[model samples]
Target: MKMIKTSMLTSVIFSFLWVSGGTALAEEPNLEAESAILVDAETGKIIYDDEIDVILPPASMTKIMTEYLVNEAVKSGKIAWDDEVKISDTVRELSLETNLSNVPLRQDETYTVKELYEAMAIYSANGATIALAEHVAGSEGEFVKLMNEKAKEIGMENYKFVNSTGLNNKSMDGQHPKGTKADEENMMSARATATLAYHLLKEYPETLETTSIRAKTFKEGTEDYIDMQNWNWMLPGSVFAYEGVDGLKTGYTDMAGNAFTGTAERDGMRFISVVMRTDSREARFKETAKLLDYGFDTFTYEKVIEKGESVKGKKALPVSKGKEDAVTVAAGHTLSVLVEKDQKEKMTPVVTLNKKYFNEDGELIAPLKKGQAVGLITIENDKDDEYLQEEMRENVKVPLVIQEDVEKAGWFSLSLRSIGGFFGEMWSGAASFVKELF
Candidate 1:
């Protein structure tokens, strides 16, 4: 959908020239992580995959899902930024724990949804997260169901959300979300984590505006003000800051170790990266930098196929019964992909008419409408790289559409054509018999 933003056929695609082939590639980064992956945020193209499918505790990184649901609630008018959320005993008690990330939420105190969400997203505050979850779902445990439901709806595989806060149930003080075990924790594979981030950024890009905040005071100027610093060190002016690095979640626990879901955009290309079970706090961001560096240094986005570009051999398709015998077609829109800086020529377009538009005998039926998509031109490459999420494969494809309307043939014309076709078949059969006899 990134390339589809343009008017389907009006604008011209400028030549994006890059050096193709013959240069040595930067040595692929060797990561000290249990699982890691790097993908183009726009296309979900997997640039680097190291144990990507391995399931691991996601730590506070679980908040991404919470953030997504909050956005959904706000957008659906189920909740509002200005809505007051009264702190509960659970929230008050959790905020008192000195070990967990938190902002003070006093009993009987009510804060706006906007304030709690900023605390949850910016500071990874567990207490504020639970308050927002309860505000949206009536309870944090009920909110866990929403998280898993969303994960499945969005194509995440084998993901488990036992709590809304990405904290261990044991850490929940006997108040873990219902239907979850006391010892359980939130779990997701590297691929699933990146996929969640992808949908979060794509569906609700505004989440970044909060995540990108380096420092802010919660309820400033009041006794309630708590100076909050974003846990993501990769943002601007922070230690280990990486340019173009924006808002994303970070996580840590004894079982999950140091993990980060980091995203950065450079020169119009953005990448989402995940590193799980890295050694320490510093290592997570450093490892994420390696991934971000690899993506920024390695690939450049390219629109390999222009809108209305003719597929090399597929100019038109035979119609089963139409005023015209065939319908002319071309690529309905542009085809874009993340190509290695030196390997632009490797992308290939594979064209096939959609079977849904064809009859049982594989004939396209008419009347066919002009500008209606009839086929797909999929991008293939010599590398055969797989996407981080299998569903993202659809991103590398564009529709092949008819060039003009085709009216159905009149019955009289169809009858005449049918008579001619019968004679033509007879003649061809006789010729074949003659050739066999000879």
Candidate 2:
């Protein structure tokens, strides 16, 4: 998995680029929000951001991690979507603990796993989340451990979990306290939340089905049905305008005001954006729109190299003692780039062919075996030198592999080839020595 460095567009250059699209670069909007980030979901590339790593409360966006663990369990067959779940006393107990968001439930009310999942994803229901926590791990404390473990698995190093729900140590009496409570606040960086959300989308697509639902009704043997509407207002109304805006989650608190983690796919390009602690709900939407607009308009997603396509301009490598003359070499995976529209003309893929095979002459050969090491191709743009040096440089190299198998020659053929190679090496050395002597 090659991490390609992307060219960064400066504000000055970005202004010029926006004119090409006919939209006067809007005043660099004031995003006084506490934390913000935008990422290309497919490539896990940070397209835009501000204070991304500063620790902050995630609010309901914490549910993304909860959804991640549950979805993973489902995919691994440890949990079934239709499996029945009983609302244990712990679930009811937690519901009492948090009243801001919940699907009111009575003791002994039973619901299916899928229904609870929907409530948690669509409504950010605290009760449903606690219910899931208890069902999956027998206790919220154990579930918090799993949450931290999953975070470590995904390289979210700066994050720690004290609870599955994103509740930091708010004084039970509204009094300011010190010590771990100061840092013990359950929190995730803007970057971490976005990264976790990106991983969830890649690994468990079913979350989208639940997260995107506008509203759902749950009837768990209760007299009244609890209908919950999705908090992400970008679905159709109540927020910033963008086509194809599906879902994600929304979060809010006195400390973290009107936060939102959102995703929308347009023209096959999916973007994940997060804004935390905005002054109001509208600001969150407007800032997210600005960030997303910058991402979609400034850069175009392109498939630079298709998987299994032979690396252009690379010659067949020599394979030593192989039956075949040469091996076909190609990229093992697709190489895609998100670059400024203007820079596309100057982009080129630089290929580094690996010497993985040999010919009868004791020289390197190609037409290598399937999955055999071939080389790497680095895609680069002439523009944005700073970005090229920083973010895009690491992703420059991608694995090149043999496109197909190269069979070794028969025993007699091998014997003959081996002898020929020995003479070839000897003659080459003698010729080199003679040239030096002359």
Report the Cα lDDT for residue 233, model 2.
75
Candidate 1: stretches off by over 4 Å: 1-26, 359-363, 415-438
> Total backbone clashes of model 2?
26
**Candidate of highest TM-score:** 1
lDDT of 2 by residue, 1-438 (tens): 123222344555666767766443333435768888877776676767688888887877888888998888887888888988778665665555544677766666568888888888888877788778767877766777788889987878457676665655462223112223433556888888888887888888667877777777777446747778787777765455467677788887666568889998889988989898998877777878877777787778666777777656664555654677656677778777776665555557767654434434645543245786656776755234322013334454578777668766678988888899999999999999999998
Candidate 1: global Cα-lDDT?
0.89
By summed lDDT, which 10 consecutive residues of candidate 2 come out lowest?
A: 171-180
Residue 170 of candidate 2: its Cα lDDT?
Answer: 61
Which one wins on lDDT?
1
Estimated TM-score per prediction?
A: 0.88, 0.79
For model 1, how does the per-residue alpha-carbon lDDT over 1-438 read when each residue is reduced to its tens digit?
A: 756767543233222122332455567899999999998998788889999989999999999999999999999999999999989888899987879999898875669999999999999999999999999999987998899999999988858999988888997779887788999999999999999999999999989899999999998887877899999998999998999989799999988999999999988889999999999999999999999888888888777788988888888888888998888889888888888786667777878777899998877898989999988898766237688667678888899999999999899999999999999999999999999999
- lDDT, residue 415, model 1: 95
